[model samples]
Target chain A: MNIELRLFARYREATGVDHERICSAAETISELREVLLARGDHWLVLADERLCCARNQTLCSLDSALCDGDEVALFPPMTGG
Target chain B: MATYITNEAIAAGQRLDALAPSHAAGAVVSFTGYVRDHNLGEAVSTLYLEHYPGMTERALAALEIDAYARWPLLAVDIIHRVGELTLGDVIVFVAVASAHRQAAFEAASYLMDQLKTHIPLWKRECHTASTTPVWLIPH
Candidate 1:
């Protein structure tokens, strides 16, 4: 399935890209993280347990399911007021 | 009724005036979050805010609705600024109107608390005087 990955804040800074298209067979966010982690060290930030994940704009756990065409956002803990 | 995410500067006074009592509203409470000069011993030259476009509005609207559900509020306004900002710049504005001061104050506080930890917004701080900019994850 092809999914849209959205990166924000530091993640975007480290990767130098805000969005990307990834083809993955993973079913859950955790598995998706593994697919991303296989890329390289720059992707290691997603390994941080403190990292937050959102599936389709709503906060979701790593175990949350992913579907084709889903929009997944990854970012650090929110610090906005 | 205006819950917004903009790159423009916010006028707190004007917003408050707009929410001023027209009938039975006896209290108005507001909170403005400003970009501070320093954080964790670093002198921040600028701050950048980012948000999930479609999701940000939905999350903020949900928060506002939640606040109204918890209190007898007559009105609520939330304005969050994105893009680049400098020290002391207004980052966000939250205002609540109620028939009593207690409800207005509590609702405003609740909105801010929820916004900080729950909203989709993220903050990045730059200290150009020294090292590279860093993203700050609030605990």
Candidate 2:
């Protein structure tokens, strides 16, 4: 299975792209982060922790099961007032 | 509280519209935050606002829930704008209606405090004079 991943803010700068994909069927946000970091060492700093994930616009947990067409976004904490 | 969420975000949040009678509550309180042209000793050209799509909405909903729990509120409307924003734009708006002035005032205060500390959003300061904009993260 493949999942669409989105990066925001500093994460986007380090990786040089806004989105990515992982060829896996895991049901955890942690797994997705690993793939991002594995693609390049740039994302390694955030690999240890679960960056924020949105499974189809809804907040997802490490255990949040995803399907084939779900949209997953990874971003730093929000800062708007 | 009434404006639609357009992709375009005002550097500051939107102003609360003239709310008509939604309820018979006697009080209405509002607070609007803006970007000050200067922060500390630096001149701020503009400030950018960003927020977690999921976490931001969740945090905001949670704040609303808390406000209802502690006060006898009749109505509440909280709307926050995202994306790149400039100075003097409305960043947040909190309005409350209650039977009396006390509840409306208290709930309004509580809502602002919660949004500042609880919401998963950050503000970036763009000092045109600086090399790069500073990302303001929560502590």
Candidate 3:
């Protein structure tokens, strides 16, 4: 399955890219993070337990399942007013 | 009820007036958040805000709906500004109207708190005087 990964804030800065299209066999967000983390230290931002995840723009747990073509966003906690 | 996330400056007075009570409502409360000149001892020159387009609106509308379910609110309006902002710029505005002051005040507070950490917006501050900029997350 292929999923669109979106990065925001410091996560984007660290990754040096705002978005990416990844073809993966991972089924859940946690598994997806592990696959990305295998790349290198630049992907270490995903290691932060405080980091937040959203599946298709709605907040979801890391265990949330993913489908092909789903949009997944990863970022630090929100700081809006 | 109306919720907006825009890159343009917000007109607080006009928004407040639009939410003005028509009949039984007796109180209207509002809260505005501003960008400070400094953060954690660093002199900030500018703050840039970003959000997830479709998700941001959905989160905000969910917040508004939550507020209505928790209080006796007659009306509600939330306006949040994104893009580049300088010191003293208004970053957000929240208003709530109800038949009494308590409900209005409480609902306004609830909306602001939820918007702070629940919304998808992110803020990054640049300090021209310093060598590096800072990216801040919700506390």
Candidate 4:
């Protein structure tokens, strides 16, 4: 499945890019996160325990199922009011 | 209920006035958050706010819905600013209208507290002396 991955704030700055369209065989949000984490050290920001995930613009848990062409966003905990 | 995410300045008074008039809307409450000059014991010069465009609106709208679900709310409006912001600039505005003051006040407080850590927005504080901007972590 192909997933549209989005990074914001510190995550984006750590990776030096805001988005990526990656092909993955993962079936869940956590699986896809592992795929990215295996890439290299720069992706280490995603390993943060405080990281948040969203599927198709709505906040979801890592156990959430993934689908083809799904939009997945990963970012740190929100600091805005 | 309405949610807006824009870099433009938010007019709190105008937003309050735009709420639909209702005989039951006997009370209105609002909370406006501003960019402060200091954070983490540093003198901050500016604040840089960023958010996921479409996702941000959806998140805020969801908050508005939740506020209504939890309270007897007549209307809700959430306005948040993005991009570069200087000290004293308004960063967020949350308004709630209800049939009574208790509901209006409680709903407004609930919305603000939930918004602090529930949305996609992030804030980076630029210090007066440091070249690097520090990303803020909500407490």
| A15-73: candidate 3 lDDT, tens digit per residue | 89789999999999999999989989999988988989999889999999999999999
- Pairs of residues clashing in candidate 1: none
RMSD to the hidden true structure, all candidates? 1.3, 3.8, 1.3, 1.4
Candidate 4 segments whose C-alpha is farther than 4 A from its true place: none
**Compared with the true structure, what per-residue lDDT tens digits does model 1 show for residues B20-134?**
6568899999999999888888888999998889989999988888998999999999999999999888999999999999999999999999889999898888985777778
What tens digits encode model 3's per-residue C-alpha lDDT throughout B23-115?
888999999888888888888899999898889999999898999999989999999999999988889999999999999999998898898
Q: What is candidate 3's CA lDDT for residue A57?
A: 88
Between candidates 2 and 4, the lDDT winner:
4
After superposing all C-alphas onto the true structure, candidate 1 shows an RMSD in angstroms of: 1.3
Model 1 chain B worst lDDT window (10 residues): B130-139
Q: What TM-score quantifies how close candidate 3 is to the native fold?
A: 0.95
Ranked by DockQ, the better of candidates 2 and 3 is 3
Give the TM-score of each candidate. 0.95, 0.74, 0.95, 0.95
Q: What is the Cα-based lDDT of residue B29 in candidate 1?
A: 95
Query: What CAPRI-style quality would you assign to candidate 2?
Result: acceptable
Q: Is the docking of candidate 1 incorrect, acceptable, medium or high quality?
A: high
Highest-lDDT candidate = 3
Which tens-of-lDDT digit does each residue in A9-81 have in candidate 2?
Answer: 6666667777777667566667666666676678765663536666776655656777876677776655555
Best by DockQ: 4
**iRMS (Å) per candidate:** 0.8, 3.1, 0.9, 0.7
Local distance difference test, each candidate? 0.90, 0.68, 0.90, 0.90
**Residue A26 in model 4: shift from native, Å?**
1.4
DockQ measured for candidate 3? 0.86
